[model samples]
Target: MEFPSRDLELATRQATLESDTPQIVGPQVVLGQGGFADDDAPENALVAVRDQSQWYVADSLHQARELAGKVQGRRSSLEPRPPLELPEGDWALTLRTCWVEPAYLETDASWCNPQDEPADPVANGGAFGGKIASDVTDVARELAQANDRVVRVLWSREDTVRHGPKRPPVSVGLRADGSGIFRLARTDHIDERIRPLLPKCEIEQVTIPGPPTSSAIRGAGWAEVEMLRAGLSGQAGWVTAPSGASAKATIANELISVEVRAGSPLDWVMFRSYCIGAAHMAYSWVTSEGLSVDQNGDVHDLTIRSFGVLRSSDTPEI
Candidate 1:
């Protein structure tokens, strides 16, 4: 993401996709267990402070673990209210990036529809771009209207993984001559993301039936586009955003060096952190990050623990 103002934003992303695997989205890394995430899933903090002041958002049990990441400083444990009881198969996705908890709920209007009121649970931006069209608020509104009570819609990690959309997977074929075409799911124009950085590439569309998918997650389609290009050209390439933010990532020495630039940085901490995070994710996606699916399109690994995310010990250096 880039800005016309003095704000520099950068991110990196990469994920492995098998040429033969079906274009299906399933619980690969995050093998969900009882509630949200698997009981064995490790703990990670979105808001970590050096002073040890704690604010835990989603927990092991409540971990939707899709993209709702962020925590804060000390405060009374304000456990949010429970969502209205909706029957089975009643939830929706991608209505708009929404969180299970509503920060504000004092609506003057009673039993209103979506147009009368709109809520934004996310304070900053969408969660890693993964929550592009999350639908928590819509569910809350429906439950509140139907049950005549304040409702909170919390999706367990299982609900998120099983129901939430994922970054669409891509299939590409490269020739030794540094020229080839890449195939994507329905309506994905790989050239749109790759053209600025990589000049010439052909795009082929295929109808690979699969789960909910999107191209907006973090690096969106940029990282994979470059990875495909580098794999064929055997050289380094840059990443460009429609907003004009750009970064040069070299694919050599099995080590990566990225140089990012934003027109002007409004917030260094936010911009740089996301940039670094994006870089790490992109690197991992290029090197690892894949899923195993069966003939029926079921994901075998449900926990991120099983994901190919490189450990700190496994990574070399920035």
Candidate 2:
């Protein structure tokens, strides 16, 4: 059987500051040997796991997953609430951050010893800001000191799905004059973050009993607004980040073409990879990825596979 080859292209930047090089760990990562937080733990380190119930000791991955399932089964179910009300306008939209968890391969992990500070929760790959407030490091340190031994605190797949921060779901209404209403799930600083982007739109931050939300998710509040405005105007979607990076994307015949200018990238190889990745993420989020959450705010998709992430075979050429 012949397999198709995937190629990488390094486009020239507008300005050249330094010669670019492939990431040092690229080969290791491709070969599945990147040093993750848990893999770097001491051989003698004890394992710890947590869920809604509480933190507890686990001897292995299987045991940890089993414990998490038990904890999930014990939580009380809530009555589903009424559907979100969409504001009336020329264009009304309601969007959910269903498949928004970072779901990084290395489910939150950290290690700590009695004599040293806790290991960093993030090792090589990032968690898309989902791990910014993770308590695994603190728990690892506490367990290590109490047990007087090296300890590795890890989050099971279910735990990550339940505890990770999600992109805030939003309801938007846009008028022909570019003024409208934007209703967002309650989250910190979300209004301030998006005020400048859609100043004419009335931003309403509503409290809902759902998974915790964060503006840190890739273009959480503003991206929705930009896409809506672009769609309404029959123009390509345009988005600008706080870091001065900007991108435009358009969809035709089921293909999304994107153009980005992030200003003089440090590494063209990494830049190309990131660009392709972002495109893939956008494609998957729209077509394949999503979580099944109840109206009561309980997440029904607990397993990593349940989130409907697009597999490599199912992904389109980017």
Candidate 3:
């Protein structure tokens, strides 16, 4: 028997806007049975927590948290931040202090035994690109081998907020003809990723003292540029992803309208749910979410409550 071609196999799995299948892992996740990284850890796994610049292994999560509290970090002064300067233009926006807390419910977690490599930190759920460079796996391996036992490393909410990568803040000025200066927090090769999106705008990366920024974060630089362009033109346009998925969104009168075309959407219900979640997140990011970094490069809004994520009641209909 002859095997089907790759294209033929993929074509057989096409989906439509009307498809109503559930997400593959929905039930398991909803029932709390999804095998998260920490779930299947060894029964005698040593919990590793970070205290200031040091790592501490504890008998339990409560004890680990208590150890973490022993080295309480400095609080921000909340001083008035200096303003960012942009060249004069028709539509200039100086967004010096913008930040996004990923706030992914599952913090960075990893586990390892002396005889094997570290388990994946993102075994289940997602980090929204926040855990791409997380050091927890390496730490787990080191601790497990050093202690000659299974070890699990987990970051607390505050630890996640302090160390997770952030979307780089922007300062921009746009002319009537769509030519202007785009300034962003410095990150390696970020300008290259953003240059194509803002070909008409001069891209300049500036060094800022705060949490490290990542170009890998969802739409880090390009999204900001697109929003700036839309605000300047008073019109929103189609946004196309590298994978050919495209969407156009508009918000007016407390309602959000979106049109998306993603090939082979497998499950329309899941797709729609994700889109609605993205809409809510976008709304929250614009209306309330932000991080306060002081002059000394410390993140002041460390707690989950302080991020100002929108409550369900405050979210607009999508």
Task: Point to the candidate with the largest lDDT.
Answer: 3
**Candidate order (lDDT):** 3, 2, 1
Across residues 1-318, which tens digit of lDDT does each residue of candidate 2 receive?
232342222222211211121213345556866666776788877778776878777666557557655544222233223224777656644343443555667688899998899977765545666776778899998999998988889887777777788878776777776678888788887887778877788888888766788877666777677767676677765577666688877667756677997776655565666777777777777677666567777776776665667886777655
lDDT of 3 by residue, 1-318 (tens): 233333422222331222221112434566876666787898878898986598888888778778777544443445324224565666644344476678888789999999999977666544666777789999999999999989889988778878888888777887766678888778776787667876888887888787888876766777777687677777889987544578898878988898888765554444566788777887788778777777667788776767778987988788
Name every residue pair that clashes in candidate 2.
none
Candidate 3: where are CA atoms >4 Å away?
1-24, 70-84, 87-97
TM per prediction: 0.56, 0.81, 0.85
Model 1: per-residue Cα lDDT over 212-248, one tens digit each: 5556555555666656555655576565666567788
Q: How accurate is candidate 2 locally (lDDT)?
A: 0.68
Clashes of 1: 20
In candidate 2, how many Å is residue 235 off? 0.6
**Candidate scoring better on TM-score of 1 and 3:** 3
Point out the higher-scoring one by lDDT: 1 or 3: 3
